[model samples]
Target: MTPQQRARFFDAAAVLFDLDGVLTPTAEIHMRAWSELFTAELARHGVQQQYTDEDYFRYVDGRPRYDGVQAVLQSRGIDLPYGDPSDAAGAETVCGLGNRKNAVFGETLEREGIAPYPGSLAVVDRLGMIGIPAAVVSSSKNARQVLEAAHLLDRFPVIVDGVVAADEGIAGKPAPDLFLTAAERLGVAPSHAIVVEDAVSGVAAGAAGGFALVVGVDRGVGAAALTDAGADVVVSDLAELLPAEAEKDGS
Candidate 1:
């Protein structure tokens, strides 16, 4: 979309966001963790699928923990038992592998911490100036903790994260339930709200949810990929979309 087109989309309604890649710069951490766990485990099975940075964003990012496990596992042509949530980490169960990945993700976050996208924040500030209420929709149970670490918790009062998704029996991204729930919580119709994401799965999910705008923040995946995944607009940085309010209002 052109710059004017994107601005118009934001002007139409409240915004809903995915936390990890769009707001907080933690998507790379998740990619690293997935690569570590999947590479190590796949090596044990004599499989040689080299997990790379490119693969992470394309296949697994923006999905729930267990869904990520499934994506990586399917990539390796391996099918493990869908074990119970209590399955031990590093075992041959969906939950176990997912839990193991989470351990790695947590360790990485502890050391590297979180960072925010100045450009995205700029657009957000403008939206606020115009009275557009934004909510967060993420598949990570640690969404709140990460936002707090980044000192951005004050920006969003309504969050639908993994905990809420699980408790509400809502499926993860690409299913539209989670995004839909966030729009409902914000009292905005899906057709009148915008969803900003940095994952292919997330862009697809936002589109599936019938959001008025599905924007892709391309930190890694090329703009073409994001576009193919259903991003009505793809941008290298959110800064390009910021209007004057966020640039010089000093808010």
Candidate 2:
């Protein structure tokens, strides 16, 4: 759809944002960490093929850590035990590898702090001024940490993240449970909420949940691909959906 056509769908009373790529630029950090971890581990196992950003988008972008590890490994015909979440980072198990990745991500975050995309913050602030509530719906257990680091935690009153999803037995994106849970916690029906996601799996979940609007933020994912995944509208940035007046107000 054209930008004008897409702008009409942003009028929902509630907005649910994906934390990593949509609000913060941590997805690049994540991609880097995943590449390093996978490249080293795969080579350690005598697998010569290099890990690439495509591997991240295809296997890990919207999945919970262990789920992502398993998916990527399985794609390469590698198998590992599904160890418990408490497993140490050094353990050669699925959960351990996930833990290792989490450690790497945490280190990267601490070493180089994070900030919300200016456009995202502008739109989020505008939503509040307009009396529209917003929540965060993400597949990362580190969502809270990332939000806190970026000082964006308080902006979102409800967060349906990987940790909450795991504790509540809600499935991750590509399933509608996580987004549905966020909407439920926000006291809104799916039809009254807008879901802003950058991942294909996430857009699919929003569409499957029958939300009022599924907005795909095209970070690296192409518009056509996001559209095929059920994004009702696709924008290069959230600011694109804001009114000229809101932009001026933010400025």
Candidate 3:
């Protein structure tokens, strides 16, 4: 890493991470689940449109589940009632569709399991060694489950995820509420914390929150897009943020 890049980490009081694409490959699973849900739903309703990765990036990625459902449905000029969270998966309501997607995600996660990215692990390890705190700030209600599946639940003591967000009435990404909540939980000011994310919405949240740095991981999201979304720096992988000495030691 460049000296300037190294200083970004060293000078921060804490690092807040987005859970899915940033730290784990579960993002692919999420994409599949979303595609499955939307494809079937669109056909059933004869919407004459197909769900695609572009839709996922534009309307779903890094946003709260119900919000994503609403956004995608709005894109197709379809409207549904804002159903209760307890609604059945088969119900034709916003929360119901969101619940349906989560069910598919849960099934896939159970079937295939998950693991953390090696580069993300390396970055976390180095942060641990340096005594900088780390927390997770994700829009997924399944953040804890994903972390536990990857055997990383114990690493982050401060997790502000969808469940917590709902319980606390916090807004989701692009509003900065979730990331700001995490920094507060860690007792670090937003100005003293770094935000690491793979979604444009998450990067925008970090920027909106005035974080010390916003590091975007380009997991299929182009570097230029991330930069345009307000990332201070963009790397294809978290390992690229490691210092030269730490990189050699890991090697």
Top-down TM-score ranking: 3, 2, 1
20-106, model 1: which lDDT tens digit per residue?
A: 888878887887888888888888789876877766775678888888778777887989888977788867888999888888888
lDDT of 3 by residue, 113-229 (tens): 999999999998888888899999999999999999999998998999999999989999999989988999999899999999999999999999999999999998789989999
- Number of clashes recorded per candidate: 0, 0, 0
lDDT of 2: 0.89
Clashing pairs in 1: none
TM-score of each: 0.92, 0.96, 0.97
After aligning candidate 2 to the native by TM-score, how far in Å is the CA of 98 from where it should be? 0.3
lDDT of 1: 0.83
Q: Model 2: what TM-score?
A: 0.96
CA lDDT of each prediction against the hidden true structure: 0.83, 0.89, 0.93
TM-score of 1: 0.92
* Cα displacement (Å) at residue 69, model 1: 0.8
